[model samples]
Target: MSVNVPKPITALEALERAQWIAFAPFVFQAARVLRDRGILLAIERSREGLTLEEVAATAELPIYGTRVVLEAGLGIGLVTEVDGRYRITKTGVYVQHDPMTRANFDFTRDVNYHGIAALDAAVASGKPEGLKVFGEWPTVYAGLSQLPESVRKSWFQFDHYYSDGAFGAALPLVFAGKPKRLLDIGGNTGKWAAACMKHDPDVEVTLMDLPGQLRNAEQNLREAGLLARARFHEADLLDERSAIPTGFDAIWMSQFLDCFSEAEIVSILRRCVAAAGPNCKIYILEAFWDRQRFEAASFCLQMTSLYFTAIANGTSQMYRSTTFLACVHAAGLEVEREHDDLGVSHTLLVCRPRPM
Candidate 1:
């Protein structure tokens, strides 16, 4: 099968990369601690590299702790040291100040770090063994509403970072048919619903998801003064018997299907097919790995799939476009239009339920 992979590297260079891999987890925590403790910021504030003594003084940490983290930061390419003084590297500044990078870092540490410890077990069992770290649930969605405030913050921010930007671009495509009503499947926190209401004053949306999630969505819609234009439905789409309310002109699933396994995705789509009228338009927005323009972006998505295995749901991953298309066909949906590069990493597939 054809795949897009990075160019080959020399044996010595590969070995150096392997060394970083061996120390990555430890190095990640060191960077987190350093950032949290103000060591990195203190170093960055110094035009000239700061002496170990100065960093310790500014960070209010013991000299030994500061030295260890700074040394590891050097190894991680987050900082540089010369003649007993340290300064932030270009990479270090991004980690220190960039919003996206900071969000990714916090998400990886606060939400996925401990759970990732059970990755091997999750892989072996085909279950979210690491999810036990938070609480017992088949998937993270069941417990998303109850996650600690910090974890929930990072989780939502990480999710919205990639998806929120796509809303403006997606609006015209979704409203191209001027549908009076839309069904937003898996509409967490009602962000998309609010966007829809604002984009088309006459359009009304029904936000559907698990009951726990709808509470969050209701709160958001209420805050946005969109409660009148929005309706809520609580159902687990994974259950074959759970009915999807019908009669909407459009159905929108944004960054939603990636939460389930291949079979579950097919099942959900089939349900959509059952609920959707012949004329209903279905829009699925996903960040498929193979569709990414940059190898780095693809690489980030490939790693995030592991987060699904260990923490989110053991069955899903960042999918390839072909894989999602296959599921669409299996569910008797035809891709009527395809939009790519909608945001930093999303591709929108506009579909129609195939005739029986």
Candidate 2:
């Protein structure tokens, strides 16, 4: 069944799924341990299925622990067993090797796991209550720089993996008008800015973000020797008084706007309109859950909203296109064109300021 519709299930089937949900935490941890302990790999490497003892020996784990985890993996469909032997299943292979899965897993484990308990409070208060796991901050963005090293790595890796894939396909569209000056709002790490400059030598790129984020971007650009080619503008996007710099030929916000609520999105876009010139094209790249071509992709996007609630920012979510379009309209901007299925699962909306 597609994510667009809920599957109809028999009573027994519903019970089965309920059971899975009940023990999902244990199954998930078992899968992680199996993947990390090489137990899954051991089974995969065996030309013939491996017996419990053989699997334990090959993976170099205690027999009792290996047996318990392997059985748990079987329930989760990560491994199969017959005739007292076991082998890795397709699901196990994905758990072990899928880059997206790796990114999502690390992000969940390192960034969201500890904080997830506060999701209820976050929902009730309309604030990132789980953010307390890291430090006292209004939102994750404010304290991102001071986050522990592993937490920071997972956050950036997860953030980049989703958005970075879309940039190559987006480059041609952004440069179609040969924009001389491009403003990248929420330009985390300046990856987009660097890409724009590489695509067009004469195009001047500016990255606008908070001071801490700009510091990270500046260091990255400097190490790549692209710092001289970029401009940095420090501003807190949530502060309405922080004026958006003006007169850019192109303005880009990639996977950026979803970090705010509907009202905030409109407020930011209105600012963009005020700063935009008559000829400026505003490009917004986002992963709208409703527009996803695959059920799996849509499911992932929907689940990510939980991260926003408990870890990232409480009030935002992965929106449907209709909801998002309303924000664009409310901001006094109109979408001129749309391009879907950009790399991975992204939709690019080409917009312009609505005429007064």
Candidate 3:
């Protein structure tokens, strides 16, 4: 690929595309109103198409309001109009039904909608200035459990939807050596640790994270009857004085390191390197923008990096694989093997201690 790429669209087309971005906020809200008001569903169910009156009646909305939203949806490609009736479009089908679309939509709307306006402030201050909308916490992680019930649900749905698919595929590789003791760093919700124990009846797992997150993970593990095999360590990785627990056969970090900056990642990995025995395996599961199979996935990741900047943590963003690799090497670890294109957008790197 060339560093300087030629333009693919004409100037007229570029200007037309620019208009879509200019009205994006209005268009997004229009789509949401149509979906939530049942206007889209009413149109979708009609065998032929829904007349303006029919849509208004079915959705129990005023014809004046319904007409404007339908017209907006038509221009947005969420709905199509023929003569005088409206029908759902292919794009609308995905907007209303796709799992990934739903997760991203709810997350963006519920959690990021208002906060994202502070992007410029966060960029200038090097802090999550948008997090002020929720509370005066160091990061979103610290205030996660205390967020509104609906907001918390959206966060978890967005977080788990991306990682749940990768866990099944990565589980076998992590246990290929049949590690007896595994340390799950940043074990959010205990999902991966539970999966490991279920996959291997004899493997004992330890969860290390902040005190609050540990409580949530403990409750989840207990509910699954896996607590007998699970242990919890309240840890604060940012504290340089804190020492990570040692003597584990395998150390796992899945979508965890990406939550930190490169400097923080190096510091955390150094702790992992210090803790690992000679034969220990350190696995990292992440979605690197450069490693994505599709341009759309890459675009989504690029935009999501802004969420980290504006809301999650000001210093961290989803990293390219090359940048992430330097951190691992800096911590005295080397990638023994790399498996890309795992279950959903993830690259699994199996790292081992560097030789003297």
Task: Give the per-residue lDDT of model 2 (tens digit) for 185-298.
Answer: 999998998898889989888999999999989998888888877999999989889899997999999999999999999999999999999999999999999998888899
Per residue, candidate 3 scores C-alpha lDDT tens digits across 1-356 of 12123459999999989999999889889988988888877788887999999999998889999889899998999999898989899999888888998888888888998999999999999899999999999999989889999999999998898888899999999999899999999999999999999999999999999998999999999999999999999998988777889989999999899889899999999999899999899999998888887777787788788889999999898888889999999999999999988876899999998998
Which pairs clash in model 2?
none
Residue ranges of candidate 1 with Cα displaced over 4 Å: 1-3
List the pairs of residues colliding in candidate 1: none
Residues 173-274 of candidate 1 have per-residue lDDT tens digits of 999899999999999989999999999999999999999889989998898898999999989988889888999999999999999989999999989988
Whole-model lDDT values for every prediction: 0.90, 0.91, 0.90
Task: Please tell me which predicted candidate would have the highest lDDT against the true structure.
Answer: 2
lDDT, residue 145, candidate 3: 88
TM-score of each: 0.97, 0.97, 0.97
lDDT (C-alpha) at residue 112 in model 3: 90
